[model samples]
Target chain A: MIQGNKKKFNVREIREQFPALRQLIYGKNLIYFDNGATSQKPQMVLDAINLYYSKDNANIHRGVHYMSQQATNGYEDSRRTIQNYLNAEKSEEIIFTKGTTDGINLVAFSYGQLLSAGDEILITAMEHHSNIVPWQMLCERKGCVLKVAPINKKGELIMEAFDALLSKKTKLVAVTHISNALGTINPVKELAKKAHAVGAKILVDGAQSIQHTKIDVQDMNCDFFVFSSHKVFGPTGVGVLYGKEALLEKMPPYQGGGDMILKVTFERTTYNELPYKFEAGTPHIAGVICLAKAIEFLSSYDMEAIQKHEIELAEYAQDMLTTFEGVHIIGEAKKKTSVVSFTVDGLHPFDIGTLLDKQGIAVRTGHHCTQPLMDFYKIPGTIRASFAFYNTKEEIDFFISAVEKSINMLR
Target chain B: MTLEEKQQEIIQDFAIFDDWMEKYEYIIELGKELPIIQADKKTEDRLIIGCQSQVWLDSSLENGKMQFYADSDAIITKGIIGLLIRVLNNETPEDIAKVDLHFIREIGLQEHLSITRSNGLVSMIKKIKMSALMAV
Candidate 1:
């Protein structure tokens, strides 16, 4: 539905939309390449957030008054907007969460009961701690086995190894669609199919992929998917969890609170239906509404065109970084997203990151919550520059020059 | 110099740098000049957790004077520790414990005060005081 008659992306026009990007940092034009961590919000999103609190300021799903009705309608309309965005079969399957971390925890708790002793839950070496830890906790609680699928030297998941791990005992396979640290895109659709063959459910961690690529849950046939809105240029504390109807209908409610209940009596309290049962309490009402606005902003453009632009930028940056003497770019996957992670020889990522900060170049340098991946690569951490469509080749040229200068100083 | 005098000296020393770049170069120079931590003392127990960059700090209290030997995987962190060490080293535990590290702010090392680096900085200060507290 997002695909339609679209104009060619104008980096100048798009850059104008984000007011934060218009400012200066340390006497240099701000060059933000931390999109993998979080993207800057467009003016439309900021305006929407302001509009919500200023005009429609009421808790959703609880009031019968006009303002409350309007608020509730806006909130549900957000769910429908997102439902259309992800192309989920029904709005009932979409659950709002605090972020990717909270979404994973909810699934871990709600679905943990399905696994028993000796049941194997599969994950990958490339998962963020969010995707890995919840299953680790679930395995600990239920006496299940947690198996990690290994990756190749190029940071791609080994499909043969993954196939070997899947069997009758394999109860679930949870993996990231794109590695936050490595930027390696997993063949999630094929993996999802393989997971189902062994009677195991699969979960695609869409935290990185949701913003960079298009998602069709039906076409992919994954059992569940989770993503954060903030990474896609929306506000923080807002995330989405998409679960198939049959599975969600079977699972119990995630949290106990005001709106998640049908009735609360001392004698007996029953839970509400799907989606609402998963979403607890007075949610990030304003954040979700603004998130829908962000999605609306995204839908205005051709996502395919945006994705292509981002990929080209990343490729160009990667090519430039490779030419630097003693510079190593991590995760050379055959298929990747708009992220280039690298480390200079004999220089800590922290030092490079600090120097880059002085020059107003924003990049993330750490284990990126994927410490296992770092251990595999035999490094402490790498400097990551992630791109968004709003970025331009001119910015990349400036980034390369800054990085080269920073490296020379550190050396 | 007294601990306050030393901190004041550093504050005065950093005021000459016109921009962040020069100030950073000075910090990096300080990092390079940090007293070497004994290789044996660089064990896991001496390692400071909760830091984005790995840090190892060791303390020795002899004849009521405290000495801190530290190293970091990141140069900026090492430089930060060097700044702390310059002021606190060779002072009495009570003096080290009581002194406020005002030079950090006065020198405009605002990046060290940021949320990401603040944990490491605070822990370093706490460990310094803890080493002093143990001797007392």
Candidate 2:
């Protein structure tokens, strides 16, 4: 239904594509507002998953059998799809990973090989733990210095602080494209430019942004861009790590295994070329093929219309929440995505989340794995209701009333 | 009353409520009545940090009976904790360790018992059991 209309975005029709959204939870229609964590997969993606496993189940890259060749083609086709999705210079730059964390760790380990002791790695405060910990481990292993750029109360990155941290010693600057906990969108393009000016490479954590906005690695000019496929309506356990071909060639292979090596002996081992050098094991074949289908599904939509719909839903939710006393919305950035996080006075987020769950409204409650960000706000956590394009204003209205009721019950 | 009888009493108390809202409202009221743990007892060692909420459990042995006092940042958790204390309090440590408090599921809050619930109730129960086991 959504594929038929290219220009107009009909959310109801789009919602119909996701089978999981139509189900009832606890005798109430499920109102899923946890899109920031992960998105619901479309029927096409599910069908693609089933089709791959049913017929094309074979080890890719080396199998001489027709099924193996077919699986290999499917896997390579997905890499090309991701390369196109990110607008990368070459398909070789798109390496399949376990997920966003694995992608980041790959870069931190492989790229950290290039950095010397006392060389600095810079990151922002709004980053997810995935983006932070890899660089921390890299620093520890390589004797490199890790510096954090701060954020303001609005959850926006402090560009001045980021600039202050950038220097000749700063070999790499890693930042999230969007704040998962707060929905604060960081200006990766500008940050990339600044990082380059200091002769430092930049890595953009696109896990949260890839689903909400258009991502062009070439345009952004970030040396590395990483995102989880599951967050973008794809299958779990697969992700994409897009890097500059030149940079990837210079870095050591991430893992040693069957596919990643060309020749191996007791005394000598030679690695494979480009992507296979990093993709060591037999990959998640079904996941990769289905992720391509997910990208194709997303490509059918007018992204501008989808973004508009989602942002409006978030704005409407934020506005309604303001009417209630002692309801403080976290991360009120000017360029926020479809996420509204807030806490009610004298009420715990866990209590509110439990009540909302009983009403069949799924929201994320707690620190959201960004403990440093929560500490900055001096909050235990906030109740986050993240929206996707499939969500409606009516659902937000229901959520607001549910929140009010939850507050009343909690008080 | 025996521990089983105490659990039955809670089951009966919850049986009057037709829906989850009524049951939870009563639980919230019970939360209000939960005796607050001493502020000094809210130490790091006593703290059970669930991803969703924080629970502080302090226990003592009073004349060979287990006495459990607990508090949580979340009221629903505290209410559940109050129910836990109600059934298990004044029982011998051996009995507290062995008791099966099935009223939680009978009352339709089986979700709380799940370790994945992220409300510290599972760990809270574990801590209670460990304390009882240690005393035993």
Candidate 3:
């Protein structure tokens, strides 16, 4: 019913697609600026979830029944949906994962097994803990060197320093496309090209980028890309790992289980083909189907216009909020997405968060899983407001005033 | 007021404010009233790690009654610590160990019970009881 609107990118009609936006918290309208954490699901995605469980519910690839065939089609079709969305070379290049963390862990465990003690795995300082810890664990397991590329005070990666860190010994480079806490957009295409020049593989953590911007993996030329479903308004517990086909074929299966195996005796077993080998059991079938629906839901809108609206909100909010005395805007990168992180001078982030929460404004506080980045700033944390396309400029005005009131109250 | 009377009084104060904004204002006021701990006592050993925000609690026994001093980076957390200290400050070790601070839930601040906020509060309570138990 919501999709019946003919006007392109009618945000009011688009906002109607998400039922969660209509609710009230603390007797006030809920202003959900936590898109960095997770995006609200659209009605079409919800309907798709209901459609899957109600009809196409069965074990895929094994059962001979009609339900199984239908279920398999739905799952594979969703894979194609993601393949097209990412503009990947082939559907086989897309592997279903639990989330971005699971995708990275798969590469770390399987691809990481090939590395030796002297090999270096490079990452950025502004990465979320998900992007950092897996490589750390891989390093500990293999005795490999983990090098960190530092970011400047503006939260942009220092490219000259990054080039100094990259070497022939650097086996892999894992970096985020956008900083979750800071909203800084890294130059991934250039970074990928540089990694390739050094004969190193690069993995782009697209968890923060996929929803806000257009991603063409082939154009970016990154060896692997990872993102979560919920971050893109799809259901949780489902994600995509887009890898170069050759790299995926060479890497061993991530898990040994019923679906991943072709045949198994006591001693040896052969693994399945490209994508199936990595996806071990009965997957989050419902979630996967809804993810495609979410992508389709996004495809209906003018993505560039939506992106512009979101970025404008961030810039506008930053400009307005910075006017408040004692407000220090963190991560003033020249290029940023919808995220805005800041702290009131001499006031704790938790205090600001608590006061905002009282006003029904949901902003993320604390280290935001980038404790190292928080350490870099020499602060406990910053109040982060991340906007989605559904959010309006009026909400930003409300948010700025609420923050002003909150800072005043704390002072 | 006695510990029980003090807790009852605080609960009554929170109950009057239906608006969350006002309730937080009340909590921030409570935080302002939190007795400052000495700079020397703010040692690493006294800090409670793994709180959503940093909390430092200093606990001791004086003449068989438990005494507590605490601070937190978050105003809400400081106020939460303030509420706990106000109730159990002058109570005996036996009483402090067993005291039920049910007013947290009764006052409609139930979100604290579900996350690390509650964990931090639990650790705070555990530290108090541990101090009391050691005295006993």
Candidate 4:
């Protein structure tokens, strides 16, 4: 069993929950540090999936049969569970999507289609490609101008520049709450408020933030919030987009499909209600049902406890990483999630990632879909070790030791 | 033509990537073959944006075929460009335009490439193709 600081939860107990984590890679226990990309699901989440497929499999919301009612109830219950997890006012505001990318594209296509020429869309330089590309497409199509809020050398958002970027002509401010590449936890509440003051709608890409931090959308008061279920230990192919009821009502449906339309005739068509209008066609029913189980697993553990445990692990990893000669950690922001982005002097990031993988330590390396940020740092790419609540300090120590060995060998 | 026939014809004209691992080594060796771009050409105009490495690419079209001159501060990234040029060079603009180099996945390079290298390969191919289109 993995050894570490003994806490309320033991490593063995936690390890038992994830069957995939038990597998050996390169004859060593897997030390997964790519949580920011996608997390491994626990048995509960997996079981939920199996149960849905085997016992409750049916098309939802249309049939009067028992299986259909059960499936529909399970599906809707998952939506309510997600609503409670996000603390949204109502379930109608939550629209299921494929993932964070789809969520952002939905908003961009629906709301961005309304934007006229000369309208401005403000986004930070630290955003993931998911946040950046959709807006760029909108700008190109609408003849709208795209404005970027730059980050300081420390990889923190330049709040002053963000404020300056907001203007009367700025129609939308789309930013990531937590940067996937840099691990910078942006001051999204303040940024959202500033955008609202300038009469711009705000779309917070909470893909990274929702996994690590406590999010109160009501308190943030952003117009739209988006997150992926996979990043939060749920199933892939499912995500959430929480839009305020008033704004969702005004926006047109993104895709013209069976579920999104209320009535269709030869000449005229009327759209469905708010969330359904956004959710087109058959959804990822099994993934959605299993997402609720993942949420339940997360809710059982106090967030503060999880944050405390992860912060300790991150700090330990950072200290150990700094001890290696010629190792420089990128994005030294005062506020960050448990992600350490670093570059070794003599070795390329790819070489480092490959070497580490040989020892069963999995870390993400490269631009991480944020080429613009890599350009700012003036580096080829970084080796990113992102942590989750389940990751232990001993695993981080093993990671550090492996890195030292790899660097020594490579050099 | 059949897939095999088309592949054989292409293979006859250019080096086949059938042994991609060996080809990778050859590509890296080709990075060594590249004549260094002059310090004067390392200006903003030659700089390839969105690369993790400080890469500068410049190309000239001769007799309707593209020849690329590229360098990167990172050796492996430079090697990636060499590999890209090997596939992309000597092809007509129309042929290059028709090829979906995303089929690099078939060579099993995607699984091996770091995301940056994958992206760099993409950019390098795009720049070379765009240069070809411009020449045409």
- What is every candidate's C-alpha DockQ against the true complex, given to 2 decimals? 0.66, 0.85, 0.74, 0.14
Candidate 2 residue pairs that clash: none
Worst 10 residues of 2 chain A by lDDT: A1-10
What lDDT, from 0 to 1, does candidate 4 have?
0.81
Runs in model 4 deviating more than 4 A are: A1-11, B1-136
- The digit string of per-residue lDDT tens for model 3 on A270-289 reads 98988899989889999998
Fnat by candidate, in order: 0.48, 0.83, 0.74, 0.13
- Per-prediction TM-score: 0.97, 0.98, 0.97, 0.80
From the highest lDDT down, the ranking of the candidates is 2, 3, 1, 4
lDDT tens digits by residue: candidate 4, A270-380: 988977899888889898899889988877766777788778888899999998789999998999888999999866787567667768899998789898998899887
Weakest 10 consecutive residues, lDDT, candidate 4 chain A? A1-10
For residues A1-411, what per-residue lDDT tens digits would candidate 1 score against the true structure? 222566567778889999989889999999999999999999999998888888999977878888898899998999999999889999999999999999889888898876688999999999999998998899889999999999998999998998998999998899999999989999899999899998999889999988888889999899899999999999999999999999988888878988889999999989999888887799999889889999888878888889889999999999999999999999999999999999889898988898999999999988899999999999988999999989999999999998998887766
TM-score order of candidates, top first: 2, 3, 1, 4
Full-model lDDT for every candidate? 0.88, 0.92, 0.89, 0.81
Mark the regions of model 3 whose C-alpha exceeds 4 Å error after superposition: A1-7, B116-119
Q: Write the per-residue lDDT of candidate 2 for residues B42-126, one digit (tens) a residue.
A: 9999999898888999999999999988999999999999999989989999998998879999999888888778688999999
How much is the lDDT of residue B69 in candidate 1? 92
Docking quality tier of candidate 2? Answer: high
Instruction: Give the range of the ten consecutive residues with the poorest summed lDDT in model 3 chain A.
Output: A1-10
Q: Is candidate 1 or candidate 2 better by lDDT?
A: 2
